[model samples]
Target: MGQNTDRRALVRDRFDRAVGYEGAATMQRVAAQRLFEKLQERMEGRVPLRILELGCGTGFLTEKLRNAWPQADIVATDIAPHMLERAQQRVGEGLCYRIMDAGEPDVSGPFDIVCGNLVFQWLEHPQQAIARLGRLLSPGGILALSTLMDGTFQEWRTACAVEHEESGTPDYPSAASIGEWYPSLFNGGWETEACVQTFSNGRAFLRHLKETGASVPRAGYRPMQLSALRRSLARFDAQGSVVTWRLAYGCFQKPPRAGVFITGTDTGVGKTFVSACLVKAWEALYWKPLQSGLAEEAGDTPTILSLTHCAPEDCLPPAGAFQAPLSPEAAARAEGVTIDPASLALRMQEPERPMVVEGAGGLMVPATETLMMCDLAAQWGLPVVLVARSGLGTLNHTLLSLEALRQRGIAMAGVVLNGPLNPANRETITEKGKVRILAEIPFQADVSAQSVEGIAQTLPSWADVRGGA
Candidate 1:
């Protein structure tokens, strides 16, 4: 058998022998409780719901879910039959306990919710499992799960290194990896909240893992001798052993909402202003992935906040920044850094809530030597809301911008003309470009918060763009 198959068999045997597993899995229970609360927040009192519970070991999450929503139809699944046997004994009536692998879920679903706690860490390709789980959900359904991320066993890893060895803990996913995978896996937006937990001492931490049946070594991992382990434990710090678990609570909704990437014909063409107006109009959050001129200017974030009267939390910090006012690539080079355009990933928040994202400059602006600003938009899979001027030379710029987006296969949400209303230019761009004029913002003399709010109200709903309504 292959490594993953062998690992699965070993993990099943470990859990089968772990009698009284519930009492030893304190951390898992705590994580499950938090996940349940998040599920409640997402459901918002909707009843007669259908739920699919992954890795329902010893009924830890199943029992809690049953208690919370008695009327909800639930299917509780686990890879280990022994674990499912215990879960069945604990929760006899409300749920269907099945022996199922979460990574390759075989059960039928169109479920309103699919939840798993401390489960993804064991899967060989968690990103694939997550994508599969997403497919099982009904339209507008929610996928909420808590998984162990990288940097989990920091102290243990350090101690092992001191003894010229490796820690036996399973390799977990990292935050950076999750940030990259989320965009590709879920076309709909998603968000993550991270939590950390600590233990008393090295031995106690190891004991917790063993009693909870999670201490199974990785595929092909060799066990260290007792003497070597003792020597490694001796290196534990004075403040007690620390196991830093990075738990990412990810929430994604199905029938995905469309996200709009707001780009302009040129820099300083009111992209931020348009973004702020959209935020005010739709109550959507604003994010700028790359900010190049932060050291010299207040930047887009402050401008968005001031113009929208939105709270500080409404705007996310730029993913990459530099001191120079030049293009992102040039600024990064000036600062002795190479910008990896693929490295800039968006941080999602409640998928149901819409968001307006602003790009650094024009559609063809270089983010890196090999990537342009439009490439980032395409990567995000969001429709483009082309922001253009309403004056002379507008038609050529607008047409070229639209064509660039089309070549990249990025969907056009619609176009917004930001300056004085030009009947002829607007008609020409819409007619020739073959895209609707979603809105035309009359040139504002004051450009105050109130004026921005009024303009926001004049804009069409983002749903019209997303739903192609």
Candidate 2:
């Protein structure tokens, strides 16, 4: 048999054994819980929310959804007949199961919500599937999706590649790269949001993929020697056998209104500071679409509140906050938080005010395997105001940031230069760059309540610019 045929047969056989396959691990349960919460939020009050679950292997998620919303009309579809049968057996009335290929999923009616968890990677054409999914949504309906990114099985791929020449089989696409495929969702009539997350190491990681039936066949590739596999496993041992996974989660609304996005030149360059400034200046609602460090109450949101003197209710954090003081993916690994970008967007949509959103780190910082902060910005369709320092190399950082924003097609409101003014650098930033210097905040000896209050004086009247005046 051909490789494709053999692989399909293997997948079908695995589906047969996977019947009634409830996820056995606490982590898998936790992941399921997160996905459920996201779906609930998106479908809230939209009675009879028509939902379609693609690749519903073993119906674990379908059961969870049914329990959560008995009123929901869910169609659970899978390519594997055995998987569809298992799903039918598990789900009671109000749920429908069908055997269907995800790459070319065909179903009736415009669904209010289209969900595919850990399924996109297995398909031959994910982009086409996503576009088809978009078309499946009802007007104003949402598409909440989660997929394993390219970094999912890095160690295994590497080991297989070195030991076996054909071992480095193509894995799933990255969230960042995948974001490129659906620009119309953001740039045109749709409003989109996306995020990326990472896990610690290989065993736990592979197990999650297995439970979801997301494993790819290694046939036609160089066969892995047992010794090499053992050595690769050893490398993951130091990291507690934790394999990192990247998931791109996002929501796409059919039609979007005006929104705002915030970007920064580099970490510690004051994206949060400027976000807070804008919130205060505009009295806009505040949201940190993705937050990395949750330990420091003195971190992003707190800083914004301190600067703006806004009540705690004014600022909102993302769905998942990592305890580690690093990036979202890294912090999530340390804290055992499964970061899903679509889940974060659902959490962030609560606040109704003109929003002041603080991004984690700089523009390209990975929020998931396939997505970065800039992608999230573009998804929100926010006219961005870049935050940068007024020191040496500010010009370079600002220019690169602007270039990235331009590449992403994000509109720029202007730039905010923080810290003590370096005359030459500031001149270049304003004069040579030919970009508006929205504000110039002088360096403060102490970033205290008083210092923050003083700096607020230098801020331009954002109310005029931000349309809240």
Candidate 3:
């Protein structure tokens, strides 16, 4: 038999024997709760969605879904029949149960939402499963899941080195790999938030893995030699030996209704500031596709990197970086370089992952001879998050910007008012522009990490962006 076939049998047999799965699986249960909580916060006050949960092990998450959305149609499934039976017993009413594999699910769906908790690690081909789930979603539908990432169980691997080489944990994908994969698979907004959980001592970690029914290695069971265990124990820190579970949870859609495009009524209007805040808040990748001014510490990309501590790759290098602090066209001309709209139209490449793409200037700023920043945004098909000043003259600039965006058929995700508060301007812009004010950011005393986080909290719920339809 093939590796994947053997893995399937191993996974099934292990979970079938895990009768105390629920009692032992505390971390998985907690992570599932967190994933659902985020989904509720993101989808607050929206209509009840038809939800399909893959890998519904023993119904811990299924019960949570039932309580959260009693009116919504939910179907839960697992590869292990014994686990499915337990889930069926626990979730009882309002849920359809099945014994099916998530990697190659037998069910049919145009589901509003497809989610799975701690399930993707078992799949032989996670990319294929994600593509399958993408097809199952209705247009504007979301597919959310939590899965183990590449670095999970690092300490255990270190401790039991010999056994690990022979029979280690399943191969988990990296968060970066997942983020990169989405662009090719779906045309929608996606966001990945990563976290690490630490457990004291190797034994406790091993016990936790068993209780969660995640103890099965890809190659099947292999006992660690007692000598190996003793050697591993000697490596623990004074505090305790630690085991880490690296997890990535996220939400994405197939055909995006919206994406967050940060542009301001004018340059130096805190567009970069607001973009950084959104990047931190959503755990999104940052892109400044056309950086006109080239300065070491003054570029928008640098400012975002400083604010969010994002990886350098996550903050993409611009397609055109000119020396002059002028519009993309003028700057390109000054530097004896040509800027092409076709070259700048790279946002379409990865439609699935949620990203914060900062525009060069106001809506009508030109990227090329015929292509304005607004045109670029419309081409990308992302919603605009218009940044405006909150004081005098803002109403006019903001309204004019809004009109320009509307004329280009670009959707406005919302307006973010920057600087000192001016209730009158805010009210006038909201009333006249007919747009929602997502956030009214106060004057910041500093631009440190703590300050940025505090400011991010004030922004409207990210749910409002919803890949602007």
Candidate 4:
């Protein structure tokens, strides 16, 4: 009992003393971003209504979670009160902050997601804590984490070995052992990223570790004598030392739920129009994960609410809102940022009320440098409701989009067409694409709630659409 308390105290003190942690914590920030992206593989189409984060030191990871899901109720906790204070300062308002440890997390449950970054290595019993975290999840919820793993700090270890001294770096779990940490009932998986950081010399390297609160070794680790420490430092500097931080990204899912992704055959293809019709028709919730042109036009959230007359709360805000009237990738780059489509993943809130997720641009459009709109839709695991124009070259555009969706194995929630009804175009699309048309409505001179309701009346019931999907 005394040893456990001492370990906890030492860990807390280490972080509490790290006053300049934010600037020096490059590894932590990178791990947080990668962890955020990695989590989407396990949890697609699930919007977490509630999220609990452990060890949110200085809020680097906390800030990412908040930006990705601004609508979620996130609670960020840490072992050190000083660190929690810094986190609140970094993330500002709208998040719940607490001074709590991940080893013995104290909070309510049924959260859609529970996560931590670089916290498990400090736990007294990491595997047991993971099982406890699993118990806190809602049925279909996930517990995601990124931790420092074994084989870290190889350069420092080698230098110490050459100098006949003990290395201060803590021993971490192997990838295979981390795999065994998941409970028998939970479905869990992990992958690793090798991040390299080069320092001018051994002294600067030690300073970086101290500033980031990662200098603390294991409970029983012994410090080297002054002579030995100096010899090891000289050896490290002579070897042109480079530090390696192996981040193990792990996610454990309880189960999963559902949602629908709305995309277009091409840009300006009535995606918002069909999305609003669905929202008004099914009385569903609305979410547009990526929104560009905010500087020039009225955002989709307001448009959906105005047309559907749904409660403002029913329409969750976009994960990313960029200023330029350009593609998501272009706009994000303009603002010195990049959009990750995986950041759009969400756990379903109310199973009864469906969510209409509208995408920016068409299937082949890029959300990031590597992630296409079709790729995002597939990662979300939502059956897609493709929106298209009713005439002209829609035959080619619609068929191409359908082929892309099919290639990714994304389920079809059918199609909705805009503009004047062209029976020939509709027939050709359905016949060639082998897909159903859910609705075909005339072009609206002025879109309003009444018009949206009228279009809704023409569409089939949610059950019918869902069954076909």
* Full-model lDDT for every candidate: 0.78, 0.64, 0.75, 0.83
lDDT of 2 at 290: 67
Where does candidate 1 clash, by residue pair? none
Task: Supply every candidate's count of residue pairs whose N, Cα or C atoms clash at under 3 angstroms.
Answer: 0, 14, 10, 5
lDDT of 3 by residue, 252-280 (tens): 54444324788999988998888989988
Candidate 1 stretches with Cα past 4 Å from truth are 1-3, 181-201, 237-239, 256-469
Q: Name model 4 segments beyond 4 Å from true.
A: 1-3, 257-469
Q: What are the root-mean-square deviations of the candidates from the true structure over C-alphas?
A: 16.1, 15.0, 19.1, 14.6
TM-score of candidate 2 relative to the true fold: 0.49
Could you tell me which residue pairs clash in candidate 4? 46-346, 46-347, 47-346, 47-347, 48-347
Of the candidates shown, which would achieve the greatest TM-score relative to the real structure?
1
Better candidate number, 1 or 2, judged by lDDT: 1
CA lDDT of 249 in candidate 1? 73
lDDT for model 2: 0.64
Question: Model 3 lDDT vs. the true structure?
Answer: 0.75
Which parts of model 3 are misplaced by more than 4 Å?
1-3, 162-167, 183-201, 220-223, 234-239, 256-469
